[model samples]
Target: MDVALQALTVLAAIALGVRTKGLTVGLWGAAGVLVLVWVFGLPPGSVPTSAIFVIFAVVTAAGAMQAAGGIDYLVGIAQRVIRAHPNQVTFIAPYVAWLFATGAGTGFVYYSILPVIYEVAYGNKVRPERPMAIAPTASQMGITSSPVSSAMAIMVGLMAPLGFEITNILSIVLPSTAIAIGAAAFVQNKIGKPLDRDPVYQARLAAGEVTAPEPVDIGVASASAKRSTWIFGTGILLILAFGIFEGLRPVIPGADGPEPLAMTTMIQIIMLIVALVILLWCRTRSADVPRAQVFRSGMSAIIALWGVSWLANTFIAANEDSIVEGLGGIADNAPIFIAVALFIVAALTTSQSSATIAIIPIGITLGLEPWQLTAMWMAVIGLYTFPINGSQLATIELDATGSTRISRFVIYHSFTIGMLVMAVVSVLVGLGIGGIFYG
Candidate 1:
């Protein structure tokens, strides 16, 4: 009873922090930690140094790429590809979102291309909500698939003890997510009336209330832009390749004899080196690095993780025995319910990486199978459960048809169906595939 109350207090603080987002959420996380120590007499938890470092390195590299116009260059290519296939907006758009997030190692990259996604979908007379709703979800799905994403970095590190490798995680999630996206796209396409037929859209159009969205000028890709973009792209490929083929990494002598490089260390080293190469090769001004969208968002994520994960870790560690003993039977009897816990945590934290950092450790000590955990790990993509995220907000704003909107009740919004569809499909597919691999 005492432990449960303390846990609820910590969660209440997090809830308060989420209500006042930005740096405040992190501050709330800090308060939760402080309360645990000061009031509950719990020892301090170790900060997630490795996860934070990996996040910094990834952001620095991604920021350098953005500063060098690499993002614009890629967006230009996406625009061209998307433009050529405007008729397939729903199908091609999600993959485009997935690809950008996969390479950039952050879903926030979806912002750059979202306007383009909106334009293509709307101009082609396709329902804007279809692409808008699913694109962000797909980007998040891509995070689990991204080798260097902080969520994957933390997950891989946590599952290593269970004899899981990065490749194993990828093999299950990548295909599972692809199938899930396809399923969501099919369902999304059939959801709403056509733009011409939607009474709300027709009324808005007839009233001349619809405004033409300004075109994004991905200025002509220069030599430097192309070079930087290639560097970033190559770095992504190398990370994935090295992750898949451990032999590519040089083995070094250790107490255990010659051993392959650790993935966490490898990710940090590769990303920072990639940043350095991009800085020199692309001639990016150093001053613009912090100002880049990826840098700012990445830092926000780092702070959130540092506070929330640390606080949650402390509380859980202090009460591990009781938690495991109490929840063990339920977990054993209904292993799949772990996804619900993950989903709820993500909804509260509003960050997949942060949620994974905070909750996966507890799940690990629950003695769940590596494959089961990895498959259900897709649940952290529940950023839309709260409907207050930037991507969701931006999606609502971009839809001139007013068809994409949040309900007055807040949770019954445009993204509700899409979110539920992807979450369910991904988990089901993941479980089936995971069972095959780990069974």
Candidate 2:
């Protein structure tokens, strides 16, 4: 009966992701775990914490960033890049989507960038779906390999006992990200009418009014604010420093273990604080909206992540053993298994952080080698399933046709295809295992 209930709960969460609707409502399926906890106590002591503090922090962080026009700054940059050279849009779109899907969480990326891509596609007589494909696939690469991502963190811990070095592990996973992006691009071009002169979306383009998109309003420089290049340098320095922190975390001699902190969480905290200070400094000198409004925007955005985190944690706790076992058990066929695991967990959790925490550690423990582990990690980048994933969702919302609903059948089945493709390749590439089991 308990197993049956777990199955039902899992189905419910995936159903929401698959259907591309009732996003917040879809996450409600995880509440089933709270009920289970009431009945079964808890899964384990190390179960992912879905506490309120994270919720507070996420919401506050978003509010702060938005108030400072950080998201606006990003959008302006994307638009400039896409508009400058139209043909490049087809090729670079996937990488851009992947970057967002991985770094920003698929849902946030989808929601934010979809409008821009939609406008770009519409402007160029390109199929909206063509560009859409890249984001989901690319997203998988970005998140799985990202040090700040939870899955990477989990794998970092999981691989430690297996004698895997983080540096070598990165080398293997990076290529897989490229492969996922390449495959997504291949598939997109095949399905989509070529932008130079395509028919399917072209008819729609003719019917639809095309116009120049508004240049993004990257906030103007304040007279009081120094117009020096230091801000740009600061941003670059922050990124480089972040990379250094992420790369060095695993080598810190006590970075891995139960209840240990991941570099992502720490860096995120630091970044959040820096963002807040930047906001405050800018707000004080420049006459903008009231301070209250400034704070509120970032707050609202951040709040959403907390609920998102809970949904990720709850689902994993309920089905941790099955997920880890299922993925890890694919010993001889490890790469394929990893691919399947990536899609399944990403679809259900929306946030890679939660899925990574649930699955990566277990796969490592099950004897997946660094290459195999990286392959599995790389294979996990399928991002198109749930529109809730920030980037994919952004794509769907971006569709000017008002007809970009991603049916459950399409996403789940597509994932199946993607996994099989990667799996078969993994076998040929010596990354898969046909038979292995560990508990």
Model 2 lowest lDDT segment of ten: 430-439
- Residue-wise C-alpha lDDT for candidate 2, range 1-439, written one tens digit per residue: 6655755654565455445433343344345445545655555223333222332333344334444555445545555666666655656765765554344322344345556666676677666666654555555556555433334544554454564544445555555455555664666555533544655335655887434455344355442232111232253245335444555333434545433334334445544554455556656322332343424433332333333334445545556676567555565554456556755765565544444554565455455656565555554443345445544455554554433445556654322343334433433332422122111
Where does candidate 1 clash, by residue pair? none
Error of 2 at 16 (Å): 7.9
List model 1 lDDT by residue over 286-347, tens digit each: 89999998899888877877887778888888998998998899889998878888888888
lDDT of 1: 0.83
Model 2 misplaced stretches (Cα beyond 4 Å): 1-31, 34-45, 49-63, 100-128, 136-141, 145-173, 194-269, 284-335, 348-351, 364-371, 386-439
Pairing residues by index, what is the TM-score of model 2? 0.63
lDDT of 2: 0.47
Best by lDDT: 1
